[model samples]
Target: MKTIVKRSSVFFLICLILLMPISSFAHGMILKLEEPGVLKVEYDGGGFSPRTEITIYDEEGNELGKGPVDEEGKFHFDPGMKVHSAIADDGMGHRAEYKEGVEEKNIPKVPVVIGVFAVIAVIFVLFNKKAKARQQ
Candidate 1:
């Protein structure tokens, strides 16, 4: 009885290990903007989906440009001038998308920069403080 149980357990363990890799290959797609206008698409199973097709669309859902992903899985276009969002399809049921709404850059940055400096100053003062006993 003990030998039979041991053999069954070993077989189950081997099967589990063999099936785990299949799940890795079934991973979904991922899309990211490497920069303002450069888009990157990746398959979680692989490093990048090379030769995948990319479509750039404006806010109105009209196509602006269509192309294939390069070896680095990157596509380049002028987003600020015409494009709004993009989609990458591997033609094998793997699809990734970027759908950020475009808007004007009217916000000021000086105030935000000043606030960050203030935070750094406060942290520096706090950390540089000498112990009360040491001062005495």
Candidate 2:
């Protein structure tokens, strides 16, 4: 009988834990922009009590859009013009943007693979030197 009571209490606690909001402690905020300049930002809803305000900005430091996050910690931007950057201050400022030359820089995989392998080789040599010193 005592074991059964303990198990029931544990089950109730687990259910409460599951029901709690997991996003409350998460700092993994995300921002996305769709084609023709539609932006979306999401957060864990930490700073807002009634709902937090989000602001959009341009590369020229101009305000584009402003709104609040919904109950689900989600926001949408419907800027009719092209957007270069977005800024959000949910206590910690979140910033993102679309760069002008990004499309041109995203070239084919040959250059990217060579760059990645070059970085890897430099890191490996530095670590290998440290390991050899420790062994000696």
**Top candidate by lDDT:** 1
Go through the candidates in order and give the C-alpha RMSD of each one to the true structure. 17.6, 15.5
**TM, every model:** 0.53, 0.37
Model 1 residue 86 distance off true place after TM-score fit, in angstroms: 1.3
Query: Candidate 2 — worst ten consecutive residues by lDDT sum?
Result: 97-106
* Tens digits of lDDT, candidate 1, 26-131: 5567777788878888865558767689998887999989899788888888857466678899898888887776432423445755675576567545533532
- Per-residue CA lDDT of model 2 for 72-119, tens digit only, reads 545566647656666544555543333433531224445755776576
Cα error of candidate 1 at position 131, Å: 71
What's the lDDT for all of these models?
0.70, 0.54
